[model samples]
Target: MKDQHINRRDFLNIVGITAATTTAALYGCAPKDQKSSGSKASSPVPTDQMTYRSFPSLGEDKVSLLGYGCMRWPTIPSPDGKGDLIDQDAVNELVDYAIAHGVNYFDTSPVYVQGWSEKATGIALSRHPRESYYLATKLSNFSNYTRENSLAMYRRSFSELQTDYLDYYLLHSIGGGEGMKTFNDRYVDNGMMDFLMKEREAGRIRRLGWSFHGSSDVFDEVLALHDKYHWDFVQIQMNYVDWRHATGRNVNGEYLYQELEKRNIPAIIMEPLLGGRLSNVPQHIMMRLKERRPEDSVASWAFRFAGSPELVLTALSGMTYMEHLQDNIRTYSPLVPLTDEDKEFLEETAQLMIKYPTIPCNDCKYCMPCPYAIDIPAVLLHYNKCVNEGNVPKSRTDENYREARRAFLVGYDRSVPKLRQADHCVGCDQCNEHCPQSIDIPKELQRIDQFVEQLKQETL
Candidate 1:
């Protein structure tokens, strides 16, 4: 809740507002070969060029540094054209390309993409030799943690994934919501953790760990369980910005990585782009990065930072488009680890990014299927996009006020359907618990709704 608002006067003083310079182009929805202005021209991505990492605990598993995150698979209009559906054919192509290029790890969860991710990922990866790639999924017993339900969910992952053995498994999105109390209810109280430990012992699950997004207290409490449970690996959100300036309840990457390194636990990275925020930075920040390394994509910087650490097993990217996949491949296909001076430069850039009043929504869609049908990620992402573009009008008297107002309203309507807009949020706070970022969903939606109202009522 760090002042998610910016007056025109304050913004004008913060950085030279420039409409001429735009942030990076959003991919996935674009054509296959589309290149973002912030990225360099496409170069050949070699099949044998990917960097690999491993530890004694992982045995002979040589994991690729570039892991494919199955959260944002490409989608096509459903046959009925009413809603979207995962394009299985497109997924197959992406998977084939990734494995050919040496990406050996695929991560998904039962809740991603409205619960279609595992099935689609399973379908795509099943076509390849099971040994060609490692499959990872989560228990994801968020709302229903009963012994029966949790067990059913765990078994269903195998059915959905079409795999007899899981290479890596996680306690899906632990340490959020009510913190350790919630964790206890989901894993400890229901005896799910013990069941998973037995599953590991039985060889059904080769490696077991948890992905964390909670307070430092919860992190410490869970990490302390290492002696008993002996976590095989841990997934954490790490990037240049979050290395030090993590918003919300997230612990800094510096601390998270250090804790894992001390225990010799390999760290799997998520949100290397901070939910795409690092790739799509503010215009001024983008300029500084481009000046430093004009050939690299804005995203490559974040990937390099995440992969630079020796403790990281792999860094995951949900590449829905071929271009994004290619760009990321070019980056890690033999990663040029950042120099100490480069790290210093990125830290300075991170400080500049923190000044902007953008919402830290990573568009994870965990808070989706809103009870009221409000498009939560759409609402928040649209607002953040406008903030980066300097199109959020704060006052009628300000210069470019008319343009900004029109842009915000028009873009809001286009980005979010009228029925799904922020004004419809009744503040039930249901989404509050699901968000891994610990966002106060109702409060943010209400604040945005009020702003929209003021804009609508303005006469001038």
Candidate 2:
């Protein structure tokens, strides 16, 4: 009910800017080896070489500093193309590699990868000894907040994961627009809160918490109940860029982390790479970090930032390929928490990044099939990539405009198929309601489409 929260909400409503891309690629990996999900006996990673952070609340369990985010499992193109099939064998190999490399925690939700991630994750993890690792899943009932339905979804998480009990469980995305209303219908009104808390007491749920995605007001509300709920942990979106400038609908990571820290709560960091923005930044920015550590991947810097904070229990990354998995494991296998000067340099880098008009699209695919088949995230991501590269064509008259226009157009056509490009948007708005970032999808689609048309007419 605070006016400030409402004001910020209104500002977002007016501009309708959508940010982050839904999909990302590992620049240095091949999927050929991933064609099959066969598990291999990965070489052991020395215990000292792997990073582990403990949460006293969870007892002697020391969570791996690098938690596997299971949302972006590799998929095979469905024969129909309307629905992609997860390559279960590929997923199996990835899990084996992660566990052998000392990753013990895996996080997934019911809605990830079109509800197939949990099953894929389950099959892979179940192959290993149960005591070797931990499992986490969610009650991601974004709609239909009925008790009956919520309970059914909660139970299904266990069934799909092939686990009798979950090491960690969550009330997913509790702080989007209408967060309070949704929370009430999904938890309080339906008595789901009492039911879940009881599950924790009974050990079926070893630990319980939620992932926050909106205003500080909503975050405060949940923490206020900590005395009764004893929330074992909290997941938050955090990165160097978002640590200070949350930009539109997001609660800044600084505030979110501080609040959790005040209560002695362990923080689970999400979006550390800012949906791949930090790793794929403009070359100038990349050079600043490259000058410091030429051998490290750009992603290692972001992951280290997330891990540096004393209160953070673990940082999550969605490793879709072997290269991604290997790189992250190497980074965390021995993380070097940032120094004060290092933090300052990152803060400066963030300020420079803000000048670019890149859209923040996490490519969660919450807004998909576009009702009109527009690949909304991919188009915006392509545009953002160009922006970072200083290729946003402003005029055909500019000296480098010809080169810039070609870069944007060619990248757009390649990244998104002609059939699914932004040109096809019908503006039905079905995708908006699901966007936690509250992006005005139609507006972004139109904006990008206009740019695409201009390039086409002027260049060709």
Candidate 3:
């Protein structure tokens, strides 16, 4: 117990703030320019030809291989000190920039950004002609299981997106054990799939598919039914890390792209950088990539890895600022597909990246409302941030970290008055089923609980 008590000074010595600050500086964390109200100011559009990737299964039109994921929108100080708005002005500018640069795809969902995603996405894309870009969203039927509820959720997407038709519509996240049960209950048992197919025939949905999270066996079953439905596209968690690792029970011992390739289904790649994990590579890996491509940014390596093949239809990245948008556009403007040597190097690097064993939470916020009121995602995020900053020891000692944990746990305790803490998960293995990243949610929570308890003892 005494050994576990890491002091602030010693922790800082191990994980230097200077390195983290340097990393942030090199990565470009500039705030985006806000658009003016009265005047229609000319925006900075890309002068170069945007790189494109074709979805032959859907159409001959080539979309910018880099699609913008409108999930993590910018937040501002709330007027009432509660929460933030969607930052529409900045979002609109990003939309404008992406469209101008030939990025024809924008992916959103009903659950993203506290349920404001569809509305914000609608407002932003409405500024441009609907035909100029393709819009992708999910069914997000996690909260609703019955056919009536599912249909309502689907219909709500149309109104929120401000569109009569959906270019690409996914079944949200499919795979995890509990998620499979929910899928069976909502779509299968309730005949939601039958309704969706009819809607597709009615032209409301141009392409129909689902995003996958776990179990390759389940993926196979879905593919087996694909011939009957002719799923136009499928989205999968396909970063360099998950390619080789066992992607939970639902993944069926196969990489997502491999499964898609087997079915000839075009794969829409999500989390190319594994939720910014790949973006903040360790110094050794960073040096390796930098040595190879001196001018390329750290993010460029991720895009390069994702853009390596022709099988991938779209690689979605959630860009919060204009510079991130610009940098991504530059990476994809003249897309450099990775060579064989590059692929080999990235594969090795990815193997090394996973060795750190950070929690697999992708910040999807599905396991939120932690009946105990815990800010599960925030806690995990802070943990990962500390790990990446090489300040895990310091993170254990820092008052700020302790405060964040305390605030989150206190909030959780208040909200979910009857629920148990992370320590009380009981290993029922219930929540793991709903997770998109296939995280052992209860296990991680227990670990955090243990650490928190240990911290308390140390302080005493």
Q: Against the true structure, whose lDDT is highest? A: 1
List the global CA lDDT of all models.
0.84, 0.79, 0.68
Put down candidate 3 lDDT per residue, 220-263, tens digits, no spaces.
Answer: 67777887889998887776666676344434213667777877
For candidate 3, the lDDT comes to 0.68
TM-score to true structure, per model: 0.91, 0.90, 0.79
Off by over 4 Å in 2: 1-23, 26-48, 80-83
User: Taking the tens digit of each residue's C-alpha lDDT, what string does model 1 give over 3-73?
Assistant: 22333334223322111111122331223455755435456887888999999998898999999999877
| Candidate 1 lDDT score relative to the true structure | 0.84
lDDT of 3 at 221: 76
Model 3 error, position 169 (Å): 1.0
Question: Quick one: ranking by lDDT, best first?
Answer: 1, 2, 3
Q: After superposition, how far is residue 279 of candidate 2 from its true place, in Å?
A: 0.4
Q: How many residue pairs clash in all the candidates, one count each? A: 0, 12, 13
Q: What is the lDDT, from 0 to 100, of the residue 54 in candidate 2? A: 89
- Residue 235 miss distance in model 3 (angstroms): 0.5
